[model samples]
Target chain A: MTLTTLPPPHHEPVAPHDLRARVTDVLLRFIDDQDQILRDVDPELSTMTTALREFVLSSGKRLRSTFCYWGWRGAGGAPDDEGILVAASALELLQGCALIHDDVMDSSDTRRGLPTMHRRFARWHRLGDLHGSPEEFGTSVAILLGDLCLSWCAQMFDGCGLSEAAISRAKPAFHQMHTELMAGQYLDLLGPARGGGSSERARLIIDYKTARYTVGRPLELGALLADGGPELRARYAAYARPLGEAFQLRDDVLGVFGDTERTGKPAGDDLRAGKHTVMMDLTRSRATAAQRAVLDALFGNPDLDRDGIGKIQDIIRETGALASVNALIEEHRTAALSHLTDSLLETETQATLTELAITVTNRDY
Target chain B: MTLTTLPPPHHEPVAPHDLRARVTDVLLRFIDDQDQILRDVDPELSTMTTALREFVLSSGKRLRSTFCYWGWRGAGGAPDDEGILVAASALELLQGCALIHDDVMDSSDTRRGLPTMHRRFARWHRLGDLHGSPEEFGTSVAILLGDLCLSWCAQMFDGCGLSEAAISRAKPAFHQMHTELMAGQYLDLLGPARGGGSSERARLIIDYKTARYTVGRPLELGALLADGGPELRARYAAYARPLGEAFQLRDDVLGVFGDTERTGKPAGDDLRAGKHTVMMDLTRSRATAAQRAVLDALFGNPDLDRDGIGKIQDIIRETGALASVNALIEEHRTAALSHLTDSLLETETQATLTELAITVTNRDY
Candidate 1:
């Protein structure tokens, strides 16, 4: 079914106080309950479970969970705690698994102002006087623990109490999201390794990895599980797609320029790690020979010290690449807003989603 | 559901021959098909995928798939190629995911006379003059690749055309096996690191990690999917449990003494790597102070030369640990055979399973 086109917005302000608070409360409590269930699986596993739960449930905007909740709500389903919470919790578990594994893959020592799970396990190994190499021991534990979390995510999703038809319909979309995300990740990894790829390739990776899976699928999954017909699904995707891209573009900007305290990461981590992001592509495409040489030397170099990072950041700004990327972010944000206006949605739901989209693009964290 | 008991095995071996041939043929073909799918995911990814698939699939006995097929046939279902092949393929996929990830975790450089996936990826990174640390790039690629394999396994299982009820019933057992296997792996990792866990702990890890999940669960899942009633289920478990233990016990013995060509590994690789196996535990528990001193110097030391491994091996044999572990393997095998006789299974099914169990314990590979 096709989504109905929405008329231009009337000059009415849509306040978001109630929906925001309700979504936050549901998400936080649901995550806590899931953490409890994870721990309950084996009390002796408390150390690993507790650490993972804390990392996942730590303060964040919970944007994906919010999208899911509103998507379900927008589909004409009453926001029952069980369904919303379970869906939200499952998403959070998946996020946890991804983040933990991602940190290991990236070799990032700290996350959320704490040692990453692998590093923490490594410390434990050192303290325990483990017989083997501490680093190897740490990695082994972390890998197994992440697999546990991934397994738990599937199990929890399966047990979400949604009807069989709802689950069956949503399953393909869920699998697609997973496959796309991994493919996107593969592109990201291959980009820098190959030393060069087109701007189109970089943009596609960003869209699939961050835009669609992070926002589009979660929103669609919620609507699907709520038994929304095809029209609502189409409408939600219309709103979610560009908004998700804008959100990731903003994140790409932050990864290079945001404050360490706010981002919970070392400043210019993306640049130093040589991540082949959209912003990087914008800079590279427009760079002079001397600037390109500098970029090659600094970006993706594990040996890049703080001064090297600072110089690279300065070069990025000087090349006008940062400004252009910022402009692109705004372009996507405006386009997303236009799509939202052109979709069929209830007045209240529209307002809530619009506010969320704005927050996503503007948020510092 | 409790499994039924099997009837006494007659001296006939004819029933097992056809089942083994069919199961092996289907399993190898499935592995080839999956490798093709992996290559199709991205042609660029073929180099690594082909190497991994070949290393894992070549000349290997499809033991787990065999158990699954036998379990299905023993459930009193008419022997059918389609159902058996699908279930066996699913098991093979699961095994592939486990091995790929496990090799990375163990930091092994080779598998089946070929470079491990991670190691191969590392070699590619170096050869291509990739921009990042070769080791890190290798690991990142391997991690993402393994995750892809895992997700594909789930998707393939979901598409296996099993009835919803059957799929649902089999899922818990599938999940449970994965969880137990990971937990057991953790215990094994932790045991070696800690170096002071009780012998019982080591044995428990073996039973759960290698014995139950590797053999018991695969067999049970096959039976359940084939519509095995409680009686048949319990009977299969009774036959599988001890037989599975014997399989692992034999592996422990082989780890220390088996030929490199036959085992597809270097002789005393486990000793050199300082694996905390049941035999190791038994040796430690019985060692005198002088013997303990020798082990302490050699065990888990990265500096261990060829002579050190040989010395450790000699000590293990001298302490009678080898003989005792071998004796335990025989005992478990005998118990499995006795249980098979005591079970109330169909005569034909019993004969097939009995021969399979014996082959597992006696096989050199």
Candidate 2:
């Protein structure tokens, strides 16, 4: 599955903290350069650069870049390949676009302990005593910023100083990632609209939105950039698929059960939003007729109080749905870890990726 | 200003009709390929492909691509370069992205005599009796579609079958076009929010939104694709700047005064929307106190009547604003044509570009 038989490791695997620092450095430098370009266009345009810089530098897991870097290392790419860092950092920009637009679509007010992009802009509109609806202004500004981030993602990827052949080889994977992300988002919107509450529908959304987009694509992109053969890419996907799903499953668990301060969201936020997660589907299927009435009345009520959330949690636990979901998360995490046991991957890469699988699937936030 | 000396024409200039037909061919083929990709992902996704196909093929002036093609030819590129057609056609997708998002921002119900993308999606939501607000559903779908178009524009441009040198040479123009278009859109939004009615602000918006985006970048992209020297690109920009401004001026005039059937919009659409065009700035500055009072009362009023529109129109005429705008258009048009007289450009290209200048600036819709 590996591209080549490499020499024994001469150095320890890159720590996640080190990888994050490098990614931040690349992003900060790129944003500064863009700030100059936008300033040259007009002084007013500096607002966009400022917003982008703040949102990007504020907070992120940098998980996608970490996985991508390991994918490259696993495929025998040099440890000191600076171009790969730039290429990996592009994913963060794409992630920003997704989060900004997702917040607008969901009417979300906060993220990572601060107001969402649209909400932030709306506050600016109010502060300026600007004409028109502040909410509309905020939505428009967020949309434009999301688009600029998307465009910058491409620009950064192409200008990463990688070899022409490497870039060309990875272009198809990069392009498909964009299309798949949009498609998955569309499906997410469609699911609730179509009254889809089945685990099947929920799983399908997670497959596209999280598993493939967040993990498989980034990993494959790195492998392709390192000129890895198709076999290596398949192995990456095998590991990424279950791990990504587990990552999202953990997120679902946190939405209802995790501490508000740690998760940077209100308790039971998904219940208030009526989000149709797999856990919700499991609960619904397992609920008795009497419990179903409680579910129907309480779930999706924007004004649902703390007491209501407790009742729902009690039902989920009573029916063993919560335990079932926890079991599924553990099962997927184990499956993902099993793929890293293949001998083709370098020993250090295997160890790091194994650690990553545990951390992503077991994190509190 | 052209890059090289060329012999007399072996063929007549490509007529506008022929170029449009060729552009349509490229677009249709690209859409079909994308249709297969989407279908492979999910059958339900066919709705996106169908909507995109209808919007793209139904009606468009193809002005950007026309200017780009001629820019290439003017810089000594062959008329029969199919790859140039692909590069040129990418502009149409970018335009699609702009118009779709513009409609959402404006909350326009119709475009090109048909329901806008959001409206169309809203109707679909209604037909299916879907959950949530249909308006919100429509906005979400439109946003995703717009992002998809923006990504496709870059994908198409890179895969245009051109040599690496040509693609790399044109990449900066392509990158800047995306950034400038978004920045211009932000300024357009900022203008009215800030209550800016100055002609200077209007002209700045036109420079970024229309002049540079619609003409300057496309022309430079074509020239660079042909490997034209800096002199040729600068010459193209000189011609493009004035012509593009005139083109927007003509659009402003049509927005206020053109027949509804020809314009595919309501009567006095710009006035109803409170658009701050250069013509509007001129009208405001020249109005008497009494006329100004009338404008302040009726302009931008969502429910403005025909009588109110007529009064506003009469004041613009009485103040000579309309006539002055027409004069400015002619002056810019003359300047644009003057750039073509340079002996470095081929005779046939010069003639075709001159013809194009008149058509774009004089169109009804």
Candidate 3:
């Protein structure tokens, strides 16, 4: 053996683009395997499998998986571990399940500047000139597809080629992640049913539905996989929780005010859908009687025109709800980023995490 | 040490009622644990948890769990094992998920003589005079509850306290069961979307949607848990596959002709839903031109009245389709039962399985 070349000191910090590409590659191979399973059962499932591949591989920031990757790295895991990549990729499949079902419940027509899952299938029904109501067909297909994603998530995790003990160690967090997310979804349904929920209720929803599910659990999952000690696990949570809150707050702002082209969702869409976001709750709490009246008339009106939306927008800003939300977001971002500055984690990991926090919380979409 | 009558010489052969009671006991305990998890998160979730408890505990024949138990017994697993009971009971939760989603997709009004999951929630919304469309609220709740059941199924299975190796061995079958069932559902959806399907298509649907999932996989799971050899596993599949098909055929017969009081569904419910059942396909294929005219007019009519149903029923009999289906059921039942006799299984196990096969296939409901 010649000493012609020496191994690099450590794997270079995986670039965001490279991380995304690797995740995508794993996801594609996984889906292709699943597609074969479906095909073996029946060729008629080709359409559904094709649609799933597209829905999963198509778009959105791979934030959850990236956070998981970094969490593992921060806990002293090898950057080049293939098993960690496989485990991290499972989150995207779970997210796919959530989004597909979410769109069905919301009756959303579009996502990512294209037809949502149900809408796409509904269009397929119309084009095929198939029997029965196209809308119902779409909804049914979406439900089954969502169920498939959920199943595939478990299958992928178990088949990730990790040691059985390691998989067992991570199982509790995985189970908790699901239960919490579903509970959050259930609470979200309650808001619309019970009518104009309190800001506290909105915050609780944020904790379970968006913050923990979108960020905290993914990080914990990664940390656990690396056999990180309690101290490291606590650090991950402290960094993740506030950052998650900030991320959702940003989403709330984007839902109301961001450009549709950038966000891939209509401006004031949350208001139109009557979503009980914290910002809306704050606006309700702070608005003048006259402003409240305008909100009652214009907010949540499904057919609300530009004038109505503009009026509600004015009320949100005039009552200082928008400013307050922005301030809260900044506070969360600061609290999250402060943990990284004097951390025990490696310098590269800290720098990467910091950049991620800024990019997520400060995004326009 | 007191021998205590030597454990009753092979466990006294658990009676059907006792087996059901035991399964119910385990399920109640599991749900209680899950209920605490929900309550710890939010008190508002109490209603949802309560609903889940009632929906799960109130009804069902517990056939899947029983079959799983017998599968274990036939494979020489310990009759007194609590872990097997836990693993077996997981099937009930899985069934709950499937039925809840099935009801939603079918827009079903009732199940087991009570309002369906969605309808029950919708009615609650109406009674509370809550905001938004009650129908939409109901659908949303059903979807979430269904997802919860799916998650809980996995959770329960993982926590069953079986050896890791045993659980790992059964994992592939458990995963396959879900994927196959979902694909079956997808195929069922395609039937309606593509218009009236052929008899072969209906048989394929039965094989996947009903036969393999409801029988073959559960038996395989139990057998695998016992470390049953390939010969024993093959025998279980042979017994289960045909029995499952017969069970579904019986269900098809009951859907049209069984008493509403016994079946817990409106008479001719499947016809109203336009389900493309094997019997229906047979009827269509065999009907004369004049008979076909009546079949086309009366079959799959949503508002099908007693007289219209009678006309279709008469046509089915006149075409010899009902007789053909009945003969097919007998053929499958005999084929399934033959695997039990002169088998490697214990005599007691053979007898109990024989009883189950007859009861499932011969039931009115």
Candidate 4:
């Protein structure tokens, strides 16, 4: 048989949008499977399964899966590896567990312009006219749902059609990713508990809470699947850690200064929540007497409104902390990209990773 | 090999108290390993780890591990099976995770006469004189700690040194145990939401939430590891389910009628918390119109005090509901013990399981 023709060599690398669509497809299918499984256990749980599907599939970028995909490809993995896609998609459920529980812990009412899980369930408690206090009902539902998601994460990962050898080899990385992320979450809880930590401590939290699992370990998981040696894993981590920090730093900036339309959260929402983000630490350390007075009056104030937020924003700008943070982001972005230079990854994978790096640093949301 | 002496057949079967202490040894060692791992990650997290170890090793009867060990021995597993013990101890950490998060979901202030994880952390927040509301801070800390416990459960299980074949075989059972428990919790949330469910529904909740996982699956996990056949597993489940149901029924009774010193909860704490247990369903169904009205007024009332609790108890006794419940417990207890006959288990192991069945039904706490 004669080949007709070949596609152009200069075609763009795998677009993140396409990757996201595929990952979402895998996730939705998993949710549907879970619905059926849960149905067998109890039909009364159908409402919960429906909410779980919505909470998972309806929102957020599948960023961790993307990192894993590229890392798999970079480690000489095939383009058509469905096992990687399915296994990586489990990360979304893990992320879902984190978000649902995080919202309850933070008492957040909204996420992605929709009511957070606890808020929705709390309202459902009232609307269904269920027994007990609505608030407790909501919190309980979220907790149970979250625990379900976490259990499903392990179930999906083990059942993802990967060879037993591949799964066994990659188990440590997977396990470490979870332990680190949970520790980081604990560190996040400690931020305010420490009564306004030093800036260095804030950065440490970012590294543990956001960096390794969010970026590095996802990549490492992919690499491990392809038998990525220690050298390759280290290289993947080199690119991952700095990039993950940059991502969170940008997120912190957007939390304070980004438009609500793009960010999906109200302006100064993190401040009012007393997030104790690195941005807050940096700005507070740099603020003048007048700026400090403004921060003290308005920051984390429950009654904080547009005008009060505007005052804090104005002070942040005046302190030049905002500009310094941007400068730091640029530094991290450069350091992250620098790791790409010597990596043995394929050209297409490299192109996609480069695209991802840019998207993370520059995104408004 | 020369036999020095013949062992006496008059020796006691697996004493639960002794088994509990041995299981505690395994758990404490595991926690120590985790402490080292976590310490290497962050020294600042010492308090969280300490709390976790204490919360795990300091309390509870190690019932699941005991069930698991005897199940292993009964399935003809070796006496030298450290893997079985290690895998079984993982259940305690899983239980710890469940209790910590469950307390948060319930907004419970105390557990085992100690402040619940959330309450203790909240108090820590206040004591630290840190930022944000102490209540919020405490809740956040508990959520993270619970999440940590959950992740550790998986890690410890996978690292328990069981053969890959054994682990593979047991994975589904372990995963299902988690899913069912969470589903049972969701159903439990529905109980109060349903405004006191039917007796059958309450029993169903107990079966799902407590029985199958707490009693049955631990035994199943042990059997699976031993490569026990379907007949053996079915036998274990038969013995496990009814016993577990009886155990929970006894707990429900103790929640109402047992002494505070023995129960580790205030008298009638379940009534105050609006726990829609089998005891509540049985008692309420048997009440007169005036008693029903009283039940409605007292049950699920946040302000329910000793006086209100006494009234509910009086009605339960007057209507003979308590005696009927005890009869049901006995029925289940007998059904459980009957399954032990004609079993494949070793004589000593069978004896231990029989011993366990009695202790469970008779427990004061």
DockQ of each: 0.49, 0.64, 0.70, 0.67
Q: Estimate the lDDT of model 3.
A: 0.84
lDDT tens readout by residue for model 4, A30-100: 87887888788778888788898888767667888888887888999888889999889988888888999
Tens-digit per-residue lDDT, B1-365, candidate 4: 00112132333434556667777888888878878888886787777888887787657677778887877888888877788888888888778888998888877788888899989888887887877778888888888887777777877788889898888888899888988888888888887787746778787888887789788999999999888889989988998889888889888888887777767777876887788777677777788999999988988787898899889888888888887778878899899988888747778887888877877677653
Candidate 2 lDDT tens digits, B1-365: 11012233343433467888788788888878988988887777888889999998875678778878888988899989899999999988889889998898888899988999999999999999999889999999999999998888888888899887788788878888988899999989988888855687778788889989988998899899998889988888999889888988988887888778868988877887788888888889889999999999998887899998989888888888888888888899999999988887889788888877776666563
The 0-to-1 C-alpha lDDT of every candidate, in the order given, reads: 0.70, 0.85, 0.84, 0.81
Off by over 4 Å in 1: A1-44, A59-61, A288-297, A301-311, B1-56, B81-84, B288-290, B303-310
CAPRI quality level assigned to candidate 3 from its DockQ score: medium
Q: Alpha carbon lDDT of residue B225, candidate 1? A: 82
DockQ (model 2, Cα): 0.64
TM-score of 1: 0.88
| Candidate 4, residue B18: lDDT | 64
RMSD of 2: 6.2
Model 3 Cα displacement at B108 (Å)?
Answer: 0.5
Q: Assess the local accuracy of residue A127 in candidate 2 as a C-alpha lDDT between 0 and 100.
A: 98
The alpha-carbon lDDT assigned to residue B33 of candidate 1 equals 64
TM-score of chain A of each: 0.86, 0.94, 0.94, 0.93
Listed for each candidate, the true contacts retained, as a fraction, are: 0.55, 0.55, 0.79, 0.75
Worst lDDT 10-window in candidate 2 chain B: B1-10
